[model samples]
Each structure stands twice: as structure tokens, then as C-alpha cells.
Target chain A: MLEYIVLGMVNYEDMTGYDIKKYIESGISVFYKASFGSLYPILKKLANKGLVAMYESNHGDRKKNYYHITDEGRKAFEIWLETPIMIDDGNGTQLVKIYFYDLLQEDKRRELLIRYRENNVTYLKGLYELEEQYVNTRNKDCYYYKLSVLYYGIRIIKETIKWCDDIIERKDLSEI
Target chain B: MLEYIVLGMVNYEDMTGYDIKKYIESGISVFYKASFGSLYPILKKLANKGLVAMYESNHGDRKKNYYHITDEGRKAFEIWLETPIMIDDGNGTQLVKIYFYDLLQEDKRRELLIRYRENNVTYLKGLYELEEQYVNTRNKDCYYYKLSVLYYGIRIIKETIKWCDDIIERKDLSEI
Candidate 1:
């Protein structure tokens, strides 16, 4: 996943390792995090795999290695983008895909959003059933803390569903 | 963190490795996850550390090893519960603390929630500042995808703030 994020970022524009880290911190830090320890190693591995090409650029007295996505890297990123969004995938996965949705065709983007909504709707139903079961049983009274945790899941999923609905309703994806 | 989670669960009641896994699936699967592979190793490590004790129990035709929290385990769990919640801590960390919050004194729990709210409030302010900067720059048109990702962070943080407010406003913590 880190590799894909790196690829996606470089697909947008060439970036030094520091630049990639900065973009991650500024853009997706809320949902995901990558430390320099992990970032540099992943960059090296991607370079070795021929997914990204690194070139050194000099600015004043500093020479920095800048990464640009190779043709292979772009293909790999597109595959990741089109992969189905599962109900159990982390929030970061969906967010990263949507952050690059402009690279996808409009129809494909709409399809992914609808699929995402459908998956969450199914998940929400399961959560409601679990809630009902917990309420009917002795667990509800003795385990309100666990119940609150469950409610947190329900609330977040509901919010995600609402976001999907709003995006679908908006006639223009660009405006979103 | 996995060790702490294991201790917290065993601190509640004696549970077999299977029981802990089931509880995690039902209770906090949304925010955190642990597979049996990792769970068994942690359980073994906890026992080795004298933080938890294991004993065999016969259930009809089957024998099970159940983990019980030791005196040391209880102390560790308490320290974790009282630790300050940071703005960048994952949602799982906060939820796990709250799941065992009943073990803490009423005053301590209240303090943690207040602190949690305060931390998120600070984070939300930074996000809003970033949003304003993004909107004011050329980023507004060309990078709406990135902006949407930023909005995801903002929306989730706002919901979290509201949850904190709701919890704080309720006169009774037990009802939460």
C-alpha cells in the first residue's frame, strides 16, 4: 500500500523523498502515516523493482534524488485504482483511491463510488443486526463500553455512506 | 499496544485465546483488528512477562487455556488508561481506552474525555487553517481530489468533536 501511495504521488508529479513525505503529511496524514524510516526503504525497493526511476537534481548547493513513475509504475497504480473496494478495507485505502479518481474515467469513478456505497450499506445492516442482538441479550447492560465502540463503527460507516450519496448526487464530479 | 489490548481483555475476565479473538471481532473490530497468529504469540509473551497467568479448564470434552490478568497486568492496564490521549493517536487507541474506562475513577474518565476533546479541537483548527490556505491558492481548482481528502479529515474530526461533546454533556457516564 505504501508503494502504491508512492507511485500515485509520483504519477502526479516528480518528487524527492522529502517532497513525498511532505505531501503525505499534508494530504493524508489524518488517515495514514509513513515515517522516513519506512519511506526511504520503500523508495529504494520501488527503484529496484523498476517501478520508479530516480534522478538527481541540483538546486543551489543541494543535490536531491527525485522520483518519477515509470510506465510500469503507472500501470501498477491504475490496477490498484480499479481494484474493488472491499467492506473491510481500511479508510486510507478508499481515501487514497478517491484522491486519484481524476486519473480514472468518469464512468469508472462513478462505478467505484456506487460499489463503495453498496458495500458499506451491507456492512451497516450487519452492524444493526449485531446491535439488535446485543440489546436483546444481557450484553447491552453489562457491556455498554463495547456497545459504544460498536456505535462508533455505525456512526463512521453512516457518515461514509452519506459522503458517497452526496458525491453521486452532485452532477459534476469536479465540483466535488 | 497489542499486549496492552490483551491485558485489558484479560483484565475484564479470564478468556481463552479464542474468546479474546471473538470478543475483539464483536466489540472493536471496526477500529482495531488482531488475527489469531498475532494473538497467540502476544498471549505467550504476556505469560512469559508474568503479566498474565494461564490455566487449563475443561469444558465437556475439550480443554482450553484461559488467560487471567496478574497483579502486574492490572497495574500496566491502569497506567495505559491514564496516559494522555494525543491528537495523532489512532482511533483504536482512544476507543480501547474508553472500552475499559469503567475501570477508571469517574474523575479520571471525565478528565480523559475533556483532554480528548481538547486535542481534537486543536487538530481541527489546524485542518481548517489548511483548508483555507488550499482554497485560497491554485490548489482549489486543480487539486479538488486532494481537497476532498482533506475534507474527509475535517468531517471525521468534526464528528469526533460532536461525539465528545455528546458524551460530556450527558450527566451520567454509565449511560454512554
Candidate 2:
């Protein structure tokens, strides 16, 4: 996933590894984080796989490696963008996709958001049923705590659905 | 973290690895997941550390390995319960901590929730400031998508803070 995130970052513009790390920190550090230790290795691996290419550039007197996405990398990223998001993939993956949704065709963007919203709508039903079962039984000592966790899930998923609706209803992406 | 989750599970009851996996699936699969490959090794490590004791018991004709929390395990879990949860740890860790919060004292539980809520309240302010900066600049092509992701973070954090307030205000755990 970090590999794909790095790919998305470089797709925006050629960046030094340091630049990519800084971008992640400034942009999505709330839901995601990548450290220097982990980020550099993924950069190296992406270069090895031909998904990205590295070139040395001088920043003052120091040489820095800058990575740019290749044509192949762009194709890989597009495929990832077009792939259907699983309901259980968690928020970070979904956020990364939305962060790069501008790279997707406008129709594809709406399609994916609808699919994501529908998936959550269905999952929300299952959660309600689970809550019912818990309410019926109420045998465990951790019952309230468990229910609290479940409520957290329900609330977050509902918020995600609402977010999708707001984005989809907007007349234009730039109108915001 | 998986280690602590496993310890929390066994703290409830002596169960086989399969039971632990099933419990995680039913309980917190929304925010957390553990595959068999990763879980078995953690279980073994916990046993080696004297945090958990493993024993074999016959279930019908099959011998199953069941893990029970040791005195050391309970102390470790308690320490974790007492520790301050960092805001950047993400929702899964926070949910796990809350799921086992029943084991914490009443005052400790309230203290933790207040701390967690305050942390998010502070972070939400940062997010709003970020949104202001983005709205002012709006230079990037992915401006809308990036803002959407930022909005997602803001919404989720707000929901979390609400959840904390709801739980804190409840008169009793079992009242729900």
C-alpha cells in the first residue's frame, strides 16, 4: 500500500524521497504515516520494479535522488484507481484513493464513490444486525465496551457515506 | 499491538487460536484484523515471554491448544490500559483500547476518554487550519480530492470525539 502511495505521490510530480516524506506528513498524516526508514526502502523497491526511475540532482552541494513515475507506473496507478474498493479495506486505503481521484476520469470517480458508498450501506446493515444480536444476548462482561466499538464503526461508516454523497452531489469538483 | 490484543482476548477466557481469530472477526473486524499466519507466531511469543500459558485440551477427538492469560499478562494489559493513548495512533489502536476498557477502573476509564477526546479536539483544530490554508491557496490539480480526504479526517475525528462524549456521559456501562 505504501508502494502505491509513493507511486501516487510521484505521479503528481518528480520528488526527492525527502520531498515525498514531507508531502505525506503535510497531507495525510492524520490517517496515514510513513517513516524515513520505511519510505526509502519502498522508493528503492519501486525503482527496482521499474515503476519509478531515480536520478541524482544537486540540492546545494548535496546530491539527492529524485524519483519520477514511469509510463508503466502511471498505468499501474490507473489500474489501482479503477479497481473496486472493498468495504473492509479500512479508511486509509480509501483516503489514498480519493486523494488521487483527480487522476481518474470524472465518470470513474463518481462510479467508484458510488460503489464505495453502496458497499458501506450494505455493511451498515450487517452491523445493525450484529448490534441486535448483542443486545439480545447481553451476556458478556465486556458487552458495553464491545457495543461501544461497534457504535464507533457504525458512526464512521455512516459519515463516510455522507461524505461520498456530498462529493457526488457537488456540481463540479472545483466548486468547493 | 497484536500482542496486547491477543493478551486482552485471553484475559477474557482461555481459548484456542481459532477462537481468538473468530472473536476478533466478530468483535472488531471493522477496524482490525489478524490472519492466522501472523497470529500464531504472536501467540507463541507471548507464551515464551510467560505472558500467557498454553495448554492442550481435547475437544471431541481433536487436541486444541488453548491460551490463558498469566498474572504477568494481566499486569501488562493493565499497564497498557493505564497508558496515555497518543492522538496519531489511529482508530484501530484506540478502538482496541476501548474494547478492553471494562478491565480499567471507572476513574481510569473516564480519564482516558477525556484525554482521548481532548487530543482529538486539539488535532481537529489543526485540521481546520489546514483546510483554511488549502482553501486559500488551491494551487494543485488534485485540490478537490486532497480537500475531500482532509474533510474525511475531520469528520472521522469529530465522530470519535462525539463517541467519547457519549460513553463518558452514560450513567453506567450496563445501562445501555
Candidate 3:
């Protein structure tokens, strides 16, 4: 997945490893992100596979290399775009934690749920701000497409907040 | 994560590796799952660490080993339950694909969104059935807590389906 993300990003514009990391952090950090530990190795493998080409540019005293998608890379990325998305069946840490939350007492469970809900609310606010920025931007061919993905993030967070509220409300009803 | 999950399940009952796999497959397979390749080694490591104790039981002609959580195992599991859930910054494969989807023609893009929405709708329907089942079950202490997680899944899928519909509808508006 990281490999394809790198190829797709380079297909947009040439980038060094540092640049790719920065772009992902700024843009799709909500849904997709890669760390330096994993990024460099995937870049090297992409280069070896002839999916991307690297060229060095002089930045003052330092020579920085940039990755650009090759013809083969473009072809491969097109194929990938047409492929159906994989069902995500793993790494749902939040839900997994909640599943075993019965180990805690009622008060403790309540405290955790409250805290988790607050954190999600805070995160959702940031996404809304991002949505505003994207909506206001003009003339980018990919604007709505990016907003579509952001909407997914925002809506999921909203649903989570609703779920959290329902759980808390049920607790209140029980107490009454 | 799988380690803690195995420990949590064994805490509920004595389970052999096969039983553990089956239990996860039937239950938390949505958010947490493991293949035998990863599961067996983790079990062996947990046993070596004395987090779980193994007992031999005869199953007809075969001797089967079952895992039971130790006192230490329960303590460890308790700590894990209280720990904050990790944020999932990676593996949003659908949104990642959608982000670059402008590269495709509009008709193709609409087709993908429709297909994506249909799949989400199907998955959400199954979750609703599971939610109904949980509601009807009696005498399960952790029933509501488990329902809370299932609700999260249902809500997210509903949100995704909505996003897909919104995008497809916007495309229709533009075309008209």
C-alpha cells in the first residue's frame, strides 16, 4: 500500500522522501500516513522495480534526490486505481479496547468512554476545519475528490461521537 | 494486540489454539483477527512468559492443550484494558484510493463510488442483524459493551455509504 501511495503521489508531482512525508502529513494525514522508517525502503524498492525513477537536484550545498513516476509506474498506478478496495478487518484498536472494557468497573468504564469521546470530538473539529479549507479552495481539478475523502473521515468521526453519546446516555438512564 | 486479545479470550475460558482461532473468527473478526502463522508463535511466547498456563486434556485418542490465563495474565490484561487506544493513521485504503481517483474518467469514477456504496450497504445490513442478535441474547454480562463496538462499526459503514452517495449525486448534478 505504501508502495502504491508513493507511486500515486509522485504521479501528481515529483518528490523526495522528505517531501512525500510532508505532503502526506499535510493532506491525507487523516486517512493515509507513512513514517520515515518505512518510507525510504519502499522508495528504494519502487526504484528497483522500475516503477519510479530518481533524479538528484542540487539544493544549495546538499544534493537531494526526487522520485518521479515512470511510464511503468503510471501504468501500474492506473491498474491499482481500478482495483477494488480491500475490506479492513484488522487494526481497529479502539473497538478492540472497547470489546474488553468489561474488565473495568462501571465507574472506570464510564470515565474511559467519556475521555475517548472527548478526544474524538477534538479530532473531529480539526477535520471540519480542513473541510472548510478545501471547500474554499478553487480551480483544483482534484478538489472535490480530496473533499470526498475528507468527508469520509469527518462522517466516521461524527458517527463515533454519536455512538459515544448513546452509550453515555444509556448509562444515565440506568442511574436514574 | 493479538497477544492481549488471546489473553483476554483465554481469561474468559480455557481454549486451545484452535478454539481461540474459532472464537476470534466468529466474534471480533471485524476489528481483530490473526492467522495461525502469527497466532501460534504469540501463544508460545505468552506461555513462556507465564502469562498463560497450559493444561493437557484428552479429546478421544488425542491430547489437546488448553490455555488459561494466570493471575499475572489477568493483571496484564487489566493494564491493557486501561491503556489508551492507538490511533489508526494508516490502512484507510478506500479513502486513499478515492484521493487519487480524479485520474480516472468521470463515468468510471461514478461507477466505482456506486460499487463502493453498495458494498458498504451490504456490510452494514449484516452488522444490523448482529446488533439485533446481541439485543435478544440474555445473561451476557458484557452484552452492552460488545454492542457498543458493533454500533461503531455500523455507524462508520453508514457514513461511508452516505459519502459515496453524496459524491455520486454531485456527479449527476454536474452532468445535468
The global C-alpha lDDT for each of the candidates, from Candidate 1 onward, is 0.79, 0.83, 0.67
Error of 1 at A133 (Å): 1.8
Question: How well does each candidate reproduce the native contacts, as fnat?
Answer: 0.33, 0.53, 0.53
Candidate 3 lDDT over A85-166, as tens digits, reads: 2324343332444543544567766777787788778766776776565557654455566456656666676777777788
| Per-residue lDDT value at B41 in model 3 | 91
Docking class of 2: medium
Clashing pairs in 1: none
Which stretches of model 3 miss by more than 4 angstroms? Answer: A88-176, B88-176
Top TM-score hit: 1
TM-score of 1: 0.93
Output the lDDT of residue A133, model 3.
Answer: 58
The number of the candidate with the highest DockQ is 2
Task: Write the residue-wise lDDT of candidate 2 on A6-52 in tens digits.
Answer: 99999989999899988887787776788899999999999999999
Kindly report which residue stretches of model 1 are placed more than 4 angstroms away from their true locations once superposed: A90-93, A139-141, A170-176, B90-93, B171-176
Per-model i-RMS: 3.5, 3.2, 12.3
